[model samples]
Target: MSGILAGKRILVTGVITDASIGFHVAKFAQEEGAEVILTGFGRLSLVERIAKRLPKPAPVIELDVQNQEQLDGLEGKIREYLGDDASLDGVVHSIAFGPQGAFNFLEASWEDVSTAVHVSAYSLKSLTTACLPLMEERGGSVVGLTFDAQFAWPKYDWMGVAKAALESTSRYLARDLGAKNIRCNLIAAGPVKSMAARSIPGFEELADVWKHRAPIGWELSDAEPAARGVVGLLSDWFPKTTGEIVHVDGGVHMMGA
Candidate 1:
């Protein structure tokens, strides 16, 4: 493990398939010379199966972001797995979810919306803090994924609002975690054909936003570019940057139209 991230240990969450942002992040992180550990959300068997597909074998740990017990025990669980020598230099939080009800803005309920906010937005804070003990000692980075939540997008209702909350939460994490030299940032990626995207009721409509508006153009199938941005943030290159949202959406965020 000796490359840009040589000697770094990173924890990656939310990897379901090869098409996932987390999958690409972890894949590239390993290629860049980081030892990776993954937190499989709920589906340990499936996540473990997917882990074997990485460049190297990554040990899978169980983590349920909303489950306080899992959050409470993650540090020890990781410690026991890696022995006392385990210390993380970076973490990738690519977790997000919104119930079916939350997709239609007009029909969404508070319960569904809260679930989105909790899982998609609040988990950033939860995952960051849960991993801090391992990170703070050496000073590291926390990178998460988000979509631009600045405006309402079709079929992206409560999750969009949740991303707005996620955006705010990252800034606050940067403010508080700065003292410990732990940088937390996000990548607001454009739509890609991941499992998460496919799950959206009107995913194609959302994809069109990028197709027509992004000044640099866009790709709905390639997630590598965005994944690269996440890996870059996790590296030491952006040492002074935190609480910032780096747009990897083909310059879409910069356009007014």
Candidate 2:
């Protein structure tokens, strides 16, 4: 109860497994004395089960970033637990997805590309805006997860483009929301062997890049570094930092080929 996040309320989305960075972010947030709420898409029951694994019990809300109905109703659903006048100090967006077709940049159709951008890129804006009413008055942090979009990785394809869009979205959100005292930023995390990673075609090829380029070395199984970065941004420590991408990639982003 006496940690950096003491008395803070945070909403974390896309926690599907204990191995995920999102799950660790939720865990660390609570350990740092924050009240954490979670949102999951598709398998609500599974997500609920995963939530129980946290040090403290967190309420799970169903959210599909692509579902406008869900987006529109998000704040109300959050209020169901936190009360009618609830406010949030932080919101973690760890959500992203792409259809298999999106893995092939050359052959990917508009539908595939659109879905990738909508869920991975556009959702950042939608999710943050949905939480604006809760955060605007007092201001808070909006932290999103991203892969370094500076260069194309093997098999990443359109997802890389989507990340670029996501990075841009954060900057614009920071620009527009700064007047309201809100801060929007992202953590460009290294590859982890998460459920989301498994879904990516040729994920190891992407992971392999870290093996060679990470100057300080990288652990594909570890997510705590990135999670710690997220909690750091959420804390009051970075009040002046916004529209920034903190790299938690063991220096991989800086290494050149």
In terms of lDDT, the best-performing candidate is 2
**Quick one: best TM-score, which candidate?**
2
Q: Give the distance in Å from residue 37's predicted Cα in candidate 1 to where it truly belongs.
A: 0.4
Q: lDDT (CA) for every model shown?
A: 0.91, 0.96
Cα RMSD for candidate 2? 0.7
Worst 10 residues of 1 by lDDT: 1-10
**CA lDDT of 233 in candidate 2?**
100
Give the alpha carbon lDDT tens digit for every residue of 128-179 in model 2: 9999999988999999999999998899999999999999999999999999
Q: Please give each candidate's TM-score.
A: 0.97, 0.99
TM-score of 1: 0.97
Quote the lDDT for 118 in model 1: 99
Question: On a 0 to 100 scale, what is the lDDT of residue 226 in model 2?
Answer: 96
